[model samples]
Target: MEGHACPHEDILETMRKLLVAAALAGCALSPLTAYADAPGQSPAEKADPAAREISADQIEATVQFLADDLLQGRDTGSEYYDIAAAYVASRYRAMGLTPGVDGKWMQDITFRKASPAESTLAIVQDGKAKELELKTDFITGASFTDQLIDMSAPMVFVGQGIHSPENGIDDYAGLDVKGKVVVVVSGAPKGVPGDVAATLSRGKTKVASDMGAVGMISIRSKSAMESLPFEKLVGYIEGHAEKWVAPDGTVVVDAPNLKFSTYLSPEAAADLVDSSGHDLSALLDAYESEEEDAVRPTGFVIPGEVKVKAVSEWEEVTSANVVAVLPGSDPQLADQYVVMSAHLDHVGNHLWEAGEDEDGEPKDTIYNGALDNAAGVATMLEVARVIAENPTAPRRPILFVALTGEEKGLLGSEYMAKYWVREDGEPVGVVNFDMPVLLYDMDDVVGFGAENSTMGETLAAAGAATGIGVTPDFLPDENLFVRSDHYSFVKEGVPALFLMSGVENGGKEAFTNFLKTDYHGPGDDLSQPLNWESARKFALLNYEIVKLTANADARPMWYEGNYFGDKFDPEGPRAPAPAEAAE
Candidate 1:
């Protein structure tokens, strides 16, 4: 303690420091002290729940049935999807768990599908207005904004929309974005991880709003178009019905600050940039041209207001979120709830099978998202069952949620995070299970958002219980943190973690291959190789985490200087960690 100074060193780092002292004292390293969670130790041992109640057979059976093609990929708006919900509800009723939402197992989530009836992007050239075609030139969208958006704001193009001071990069440097609409590309620099870059892109909206900007315009650059083919990109955003989150229903707080936002086509973006005397192609080339300078400041400032008007038509539809509760045993701790969540929806069936394989056979049309989420849901059900069936309940209540419309941009989880409240009403933490591809044995788990709070420690302890290790996010650039249900909770000022079967033990290869060979395709069915034993371990690990977070005498707190906590929960970093935890 006298020699160490850093308070944030992990267990291994602390050990390394200790080793230095041991050599000074001329002592051999004690094996007992070497292990963080020894076989038998006070406060450092595994709180392994009797996981005998968790059955591998049941897990496999549940996964097989849910991911089966007969369910028609369990699309969110289809009858098959409703059938899946009913099945989950039935299981909740049978498990003796109480309804989490009011007095019912279902939390009715209403969604408004918005489609642009008419969209126009016009510019005042020499005080004369010119209109740009809707789909051909640009695709203006406002699923959350009013049915109509009319704005004549100035424009600024930010590279990757990054503004991290630590990274020595600021796309909006030396510019004022107040009362302006900032245009940005759809991606980050090449070296930046997709998750981190995407997260930076998300922060760009907030940065602009804080800077007093009115709106945003995202133009898919040439690099973006090449990275994701034009046809595939258009197909994704071309759907008439975009799941629109209500102002009060969304986890994205910055979306409301924007008056209008749209995606401009390459030709359309070129037209806008030409007025600034900068070639759109040259700007894109700058991003790819220099490796060290992943992104360079596009110093071109285009003058004049480009009026954006979007008129949309919407239809309301309803979906159900299956929620159940295992009431805590301890009265004091029962007030706080630990939520365990997983999405129940998938991409559903393909419109039609157009692609062909090497053998000239038609590609599988139905998107049986076995690993994408059905596996996650099945594991959630198993964890719930095991915990509820236990003789002794945890001190804090455990809320289990099977969300809807996750494929539609995490709609249900965002809805619940905004509306759902614990019976006694105290925030604790969240654990989200998304796609846990268990093709082989996994010794570690990658937590997407665990660094924000004590959820990181909880995951470590839970991993120790099952001889599994916890690793930091390896794909931070993918923006994996905000891509799932847990992020919805995070935005509401809750510390949360998104767990995935890690990329250890050839998991890198296994997971990568699974993505290429099966992900969202019909191949994500029963025929896909799944490790039932791995699934069992994962469920057990989930159980241990629930017990750890729910039964601990103390509430989970945000770690000091967590990047996410500082942004979402401002007051969190102000609190000091325990002195004993310091180096």
Candidate 2:
């Protein structure tokens, strides 16, 4: 048996081998050899009764329907998404599953989509306004909010707009940005931890907003532009920008207080800062150059104010987190909920611009999100159906949530975790299903963040029950833990498990190709080679884990003083088992 706490790297290597070996031993029809008949395999290994009961046919039906072109990729704030929601809700009713909230399976979420209407901004210097090109010199802004604003505010250069009192760093010190526009370089200086820097940089706008700054313009540091090209950033901002709304009906985002926010192209950023007593190139070198710790505040405000005119319209859009509940058998522990979750939304489709392919045919328009999520949603619906049909209920209620706006920014899960109540009680744990990419009929399952909580033990039990070995995340550098819907539950101090198919047995090549070629693109459709049986087996594995969690003698809890538990809820930690605690 594994301990409650496992070191990430050691356990990752150990489990990788265990997972690949067991998978090769015939965890299913496909192993390392890709659907070959391996020797010394049990009948259960070839075809699981539970998996067979779940039925690949049913899984295919749901995936096909959800990933179809008619749904238009299930974009967050679109009419097509409404139709998809209706379909999921209809399935819940047909299965006789109880609603998770208010006799309605749908939980309303508010969102904001900001688009540039008539965008024009310039630098005011020496009684002459130097106008900037929209996409060339700069790009019109989206994000934070949608509104028309005309402001003549002074530009103050703050290193990265960071003010960390915990660390002895304050770029705002000896600088006043009240009612002014602050120009900041994108990203943080060296020596700051990546996650911490990201947290600070993300919250920088709030600091600026609180400082009474009316607006901000971000210059792409060379490192930033190198990481993500200017053209890609432009594509992001040009689209319909969305963020989740709070109870107050306002967009609940990082930079709510600012009247405007914009990102400047590197060339234009240099042009704007020229001859302003501060050199952009020199400032960038101070931070990113060989002198790692030499970066600090440069108390130089540009000589003149900036003239910005942003024209945009605003509209209130709504989406939902589909919720259904299955009650537990035990009266004492049933109130503690085990959430079976997945995101129902995808990037949807980019608008059909008039264009032609090399063959002189119309280009691909719809983004059919087959593996990106519809698979997970279909898996969720199947689990709900099987549980509802079964007579024996688990000890804890299962909250089946198909979230919206995950592609937009995990907005649906964020709202659900903070607001949704399971029979007026909190969640005991979360099992998130996402991007299964079950293209290879393979061996091994991967669990992200399972080591941080009791979910690790539950995952071991699940693998044992399903005859599939579990491994730690193979790609820890990708930050998979924070990239999905499970993160919201983690932020709330709830223990979580994010199940993924491992990349072994040629699965790595398949996964890489899928991510590079099909992920978020129109090609992620039914036309792609999908392993329906493997998807069914994945549902079985998830079902086993979630069931173990639901029927556990004690609810799942974060390991003692872990990063998330220590940071988000210092008071909450799962009590160790008597035997384990005595070790």
Candidate 3:
């Protein structure tokens, strides 16, 4: 029989002792090894019916095709991505899944893309203007509602510019930033909850706009400088910014009240606060200090009028999200859906600055996102195939979605999460697969958002049945709970869970190496040593989760007083934690 433990000599000896002990005591043994292939059925497949239909070879084939160089990285709204979407749709049809969107297998989304053409930023003080060089002091600026920006306004510094009553934080407690440019440091304070801090970091722009600020200039904090250096940040922002267009032909700008927004280097940020009676270095020291009592910078006015002008090149592009459904057998529970999703897009090739190989031939700039998302889509597809082929349909209908524009801030999922619901059926929960990093024989899995809803219990049950350990998020600083396609569903008040390979059984080293070496780079191709066994295990785990959720008597609900639950679904049904519920 295949064993559950890795095949190291030391582990094998340990497992042998455990098995002997269990047999002597007449205790029933757990399933045999993870790779058991006993007589046309593995032990895992026997325990999990859905696992029988999932083929690791099929997952590999799907990833090989989607992450090929010919696909040009599957950028959203591009022809290459359209081909990928069509491929997913074709797979759904072949699996005998009905269309999810009113007989249509796709949801079309239009987006307005804006790329920076040129910009000029200057600080006018003492009747003299000091112009900042682009790409040196300031990166770029964009305004979704305007093609050109020309304004000069007084500048105000509001520290981090956060305003969360729940967190007892109000950076703008007494500041009036009306008609002024708000200068603030990026990210939240260290003591805030990781998930809540992530939300506050993104809410700065909206806070500034709501306070009648004309523009916003972000200065990277010490943490940002260490995690995402200025050069790396520039590389990320050099491309075009995209916003989905609504059905009414209007683009939804979150901070529509603001006309311009840009980021500044730390050096440039220090220069702006040179004569403002506050030492930038001292303020930053306190802001990032680890002491028990560290004072944060408060709001203050800068001694300058910041004049910034920008020109944007705008274009309209379209993309589609592939959707499919497997209806349930139970008429009552079938009215609700359990959603399984993965993004179908990646950062496209940077064609403008394409380089050359040793032979002077054009170099490979295609990002061929093998692990960033192509593998995630492949895993979701295998799960869908297994569920669709099950002899008895689940009690609740299952909706399989291949979302688009995930690399562009989860646009596709956002649209569907907000507006794709039907009067007859609603999505009760989401299980998203994104960048599972299946490069090692994983021993455990990390369940993001597991603690926020009843899905935590479902995840626990699924893990136990699959002989996989469930672990907490080891890298909470990454704020992964709010960083994937599943967050879109969470924002719309649906309970969601994102499971990824955890940092155990050599996973930490492998995952860290991947982030440093290949994440978001051309090196993320198929040349890497990816573990097919790990991929199969992950797919089987998710399949088991779906089976449990779809067949459960009651729909998943938010745990009472959870931050995300209260914030997004204030009036939705709430329950005690799973452990408490049993009591």
Summarize candidate 1's per-residue lDDT along 362-464 as a digit string, tens digits: 6667787888898899889878876776678888889889999998888888878877745477556898889998899877888776655777778887776
* Residue 493 alpha-carbon offset, candidate 1, angstroms: 1.6
In order of lDDT, best first, we have: 3, 2, 1
Cα shift from native, residue 2, model 2 (Å): 49
Tens-place lDDT digits, model 3, residues 400-463: 9999999989999998987774556999999999998978988799999888899999999888
- Quote each prediction's TM-score: 0.81, 0.82, 0.90
List residue ranges in candidate 2 displaced over 4 A. Answer: 1-52, 125-128, 143-146, 162-176, 188-201, 210-212, 245-248, 273-279, 282-303, 421-423, 467-477, 574-583
Worst 10 residues of 3 by lDDT: 22-31
Q: Across residues 458-573, which tens digit of lDDT does each residue of candidate 2 receive?
A: 98877887777786566643557778999888878788889888866767678778877888887898888899878877877887787778878888877774556665667885
Q: Which ranges of candidate 3 are over 4 A from the true structure?
A: 1-44, 357-362, 578-583
**Count of clashes, each model:** 8, 0, 3
CA shift of 356, model 2, Å:
2.7
